[model samples]
Target: MKRFLVAGALASTLLLAGCASGTGGLTTGSVDSISAVEPGMDSGMVTAEGLKTNADGSVASDASGSVSTDVSRSVIKTASVSVAVDHPLEVAPELATIAANAGGYVQDSSNSPASEYQSESIYVTLRIPADKFDAATAEVLALGTFVSSSQSESDVTLQVTDVDARIASLTTSVDRLTALMANATNTADLLAAESALAQRQAELDSLVSQRDYLSNQVDLATLSVSVIATTDAAPTSQSFWDGLSQGWSALVNAGSVFVVALGFLLPWLAILAVIAFAALVIIWLSIRASRRRHESSTPEE
Candidate 1:
């Protein structure tokens, strides 16, 4: 009787120990199954038996920990680009629309006045979806000639990781408070638990919102494009009445030139006039001398 009692006591102790050790929640009755689970896994309402591995090395039930991800994200990213092109107003909006289709927006836009002989110019700033930045930039380049372009990138990986860690801590605190609420024996305790839970939840919400905002900033790129177009001079034609008036004015100018040419020969005309005067004087003196000599010769006869 004593031996049987001892044996029964040992059996009960072993069963109780196994339950306390949580062996029921393991695969093949092994406690190492807990080690297989990863942190941040949402394992709610799943049975131990359901977690057993199959012959194919796959879990019999869905386990988020079964897969691991290496894709990490940055909290903030800042990039700036400057480009020069032709026809900014026309090309800028088109580029802005393309950015929008790719999940971007136009922040600002401006255009310079067209010169009397040249085309207009445009300047613009655009926000683009992170994934479509490269493609959209290539399309903008196709709009006109490239004068200058520069790109820069910044990473906030550490900040993002820190925020995620805070979120996790807040979540754990909330979980603990939730578990405490199930066993609250007094009104004061229950209120305290609820208040802590609310605070943690609010903190978590803020962290999530900030992280999302920062992630978006990093994911998208901004491009500032300036456009300049070459302008050609246009020719103008004159009317028939204008042409006739110009020709008549030219004829009048020719007559004035002929009058100037004749005035330049006035010295030669003056010399000829002086010689004619001298010859007339000589003839008059000879006529007087002949008359006087004839009178004197007739008297002598």
Candidate 2:
């Protein structure tokens, strides 16, 4: 989705333009250096082989091989958290307020009602300014007892750079095409130039839009919150009504189990009952027939 389907003629044009201007590349025009840790140094100090460390503790190399010591990085951050709260239904509003206070907004949210076996829960997605990500997360999670949380940071620096390069190349290409259209001589060349310019312009606009979207994502961090309801007090409600309610729930659950077990055994029980009745009927009929035969075969007494 990052790269568009550049047309054949457009590709050729870009290639020739790149060759002409020497500007078609995806690199950030900087050297990336690797650093390794050497024992016997400071516990947290990192040393690069044959590289000079400046006063600010930045690494540098020879003039012929200057390394990027302060490369700007683009990162997208996201997090998910689940916490047990006293009031799950109110979590969304409180979370929204927190996000707003932190220069953020709630994108989506939902509340679930309490169930027989499960508690009420709230699910919300938030977009907070990246600078406030940690603070907002802390404030939100502090709303309740922290159950669990996880975070992820995606390194989109390379992607951002690539998109920027493509956008720059497209812009240049569009400018060149615009100039060509202005000086086009024949009708055929004009029409072709117009069509190509339109295509390039559209492509350039799309890349610019994508770049903007990517930058927005890097600037704002996303947070997903799952608020699980829990009573402030355990061993709750010594009241008679509460006891009765709990007992009733248990009885209903036990009754449900009994009903299921009965349903499962009903068919087998019916079959066995029918077989027993048939056996009894057959024995009784045989006894009656034998008695009649005996009477018939017996002499008058």
Candidate 3:
């Protein structure tokens, strides 16, 4: 009986040890799987079971360690241009039309009237589709004399891939938690699974929002345009007739200004004349008074 009891105790210990070792192995595998889904990991060091080369030579994967064949790149494009035009108001509508024809829309626009020092100008912000960015920019450049232009492109491929990986990982977690909740046999286990699910879902929602914002940026290109109305008309070599016409117009303008200025001074001129006359009258009266005094002093002369 003692031997039997000892044998039973030894078998129980071995069984418990085996079960613990299996559970530990499973835990380690789970951790490695999660790490494999993270981006920027060295493929040589990490297992490539879940990742596959896409058509564009990029790596893509999904939940459940499955690789996808579809591949795409994300880039954010932006441009700024300064142009000189004869009429900013006229150019503003032309720019709007150009954007529309290129499958773009005006995001914002402002027209400033001419000031003392600055000429009339129009500023336009446009959102064009990625495919139409270059063509639209070319058309906009054609609208007026190009003063300056600059374009920039930013690669967001790695950022997008990272976000996708995180989203996949979170989705897997949510799935696992759902399974846990379904299999829960007690109230405490059920409550724990539900709480974990809620947390993961919230995180997933946030990541989704971020991904959407990035996607929009990739899809649309931004272009800012400044159209300044030229203060002076461009200098051109002119024929004698044209020069003569311009000279006449200038002369007429100068004469009109002179006449207007003379009109403005007329009131002051009248006031000055009235004061001069009053001064002469006073001088004459003083001279007469002096003569009377001289005669009175001379007595009987």
Candidate with the greatest TM-score versus the true structure = 2
lDDT of each: 0.59, 0.71, 0.70
lDDT of each residue in 1-301, candidate 3, tens digit only = 6445434443332232222112222111121222222233333211223235543556656676666644466789999998888888788888888889888889999988888656888899998989999999999888888778999998876666656665765676677677666766667666766765676677667768878988988988999999887644344467899899989999998999999999999999999999999999999999999999998899673
For model 3, the stretches where C-alpha displacement exceeds 4 angstroms are 1-70, 232-301
1-301: candidate 1 lDDT, tens digit per residue: 6445434443332332222113332112311222222245432221222233443555444355553333354523334444444445567668677778888888788887777545677777777877778788877777765555777765665556546554654565556567666756667666766765665566567778877877777777777776766332121566898789879989998898898887987888898899999999999999999999998888553
- Whole-model lDDT, candidate 3? 0.70
Candidate 1: the clashing residue pairs are 77-218, 85-227, 85-228
Candidate 3 is scored at a TM of 0.56
lDDT of 3 at 231: 48
Report the lDDT of model 2 for residue 292: 100
Error of 2 at 132 (Å): 1.4
**Number of the candidate with higher TM-score, 1 or 3:** 3
Clashes of each: 3, 0, 0
Ranking by lDDT: 2, 3, 1
Q: Which stretches of candidate 2 lie over 4 Å from their true place?
A: 1-71, 231-256, 259-301
Cα lDDT for residue 17, model 2? 35
Tell me which residue pairs clash in candidate 3.
none
